[model samples]
Target: MLAIIGGSGLAKLPVLEVTHRQVVRTPYGDPSCALTFGHLGQQNVVFIARHGHGHSLAPHEINYRANIWALHNQGVKGILSIGSVGGIRADMGPGTLVVPDNIIDYSWGRKHTFFDGPERPVVHVDFSNPYDDGLRSRVIAAVDAAGKQAVSQGIYACTQGPRLETAAEILRLERDGADIVGMTGMPEACLAREMNLPYAHLCLVVNWAAGKGGSATVDFDPATAEAGMNDVTAVLQAMLS
Candidate 1:
């Protein structure tokens, strides 16, 4: 089965035919909220709102371990994380959908790994390629089949946030080779990997990075961002069906 982890613009699976909701408790603690089970056609899938039902959890405050662990223990074979991001690459301008192939972790002070303390031995997992390739291909194919234009690959930069990036910080991230910027991409991706679950992200380009495009002086248009999410949501629905 697949587990869909929704972020930002998506608080629930819009197309999921929800059968029931399950509250899963992990050794790491509770997940963001109860997991919603349903059939996106014939497939059995689960959904989780990463920021809790009220969308109150900050990116730094999200307990990524419990979220991933709950899904893993429930026999979820794979995870598809949907995130809203700011574009740094010109081609990845607002309203674009991308399947990120690589990621740079710029987040800190979060419980990132399951391997900790005296009981568990120190462990290092190879993160040379953060997102799973096969799963990425499936999503790209689904987008194409859905008649949506999606960028095949891009580099994701994960930042510590409740706060948006400064113009200068955006520049720094661009120099770091990031094509998109967002919160909630880090430890979640890594934690899924630690659990041996194949994970891939479907990113929606919600806006231009701080100084680029229209965001230099104007406030970010969240309405436009939400519309962009709708574009990707269609593809996600087609992907599952």
Candidate 2:
């Protein structure tokens, strides 16, 4: 089965045919909430809201370890993580869908890996390519099949925040080659890699980043988010089928 980690603007999959909800305990602790099991199109899938159903948890407070472990423990073959982002690249404006090929983590002070403690052997996972290539291909193809267009490549910058970035910080990120900016993309992706799960990120550009698109301040529209998520649902359905 595949797992979908829903981020902001996507607390749940409305199209998912409900089956049951299962609460799971992990060595790291509890997941954000129960694992939602259901069918999307003809495929069986599981889902979890990254920030909890009520959007209570901030990006930094998320239990990344438990979330990934619970899904891995449930025997999911792969994971598709969806997040909302601010567009730094001019071409990637509001309401755009993008599949990031690389990531730069600016986040800190989070439990980023499971390789801690003396009992575990020393391990170093190669993150040369942050995302799973095969899964990325599948997502791109699914977007096409869904009759939607997604920018097939871009760089994701994961920030440590409940707060949005400052204009200067956004400038620095752009200089560092980040095409998009978001929170909650880090430890989650890295933890999945640690668990040997094929993982990929699908980003929804909700607004222009600070100092971009001729806007000094970032602004978001609920309607844009609604439309973008609608496209995401269609792509997910195609992926499942």
Tell me the tens digit of each residue's lDDT in model 1 across 53-106.
989899999999999999998999999999988899989887889899999999
Q: What is the TM-score of candidate 1?
A: 0.96
lDDT over C-alpha atoms for residue 13 of model 2: 93
> In candidate 1, which residue ranges exceed 4 Å CA deviation?
216-219
TM-score for model 2? Answer: 0.97
TM-score of each: 0.96, 0.97
lDDT of 2 by residue, 106-198 (tens): 999999999999898879999889899999999999999999999999999999988888889999999999999999899888899999999
Per-residue error (Å), model 2, residue 54: 0.5
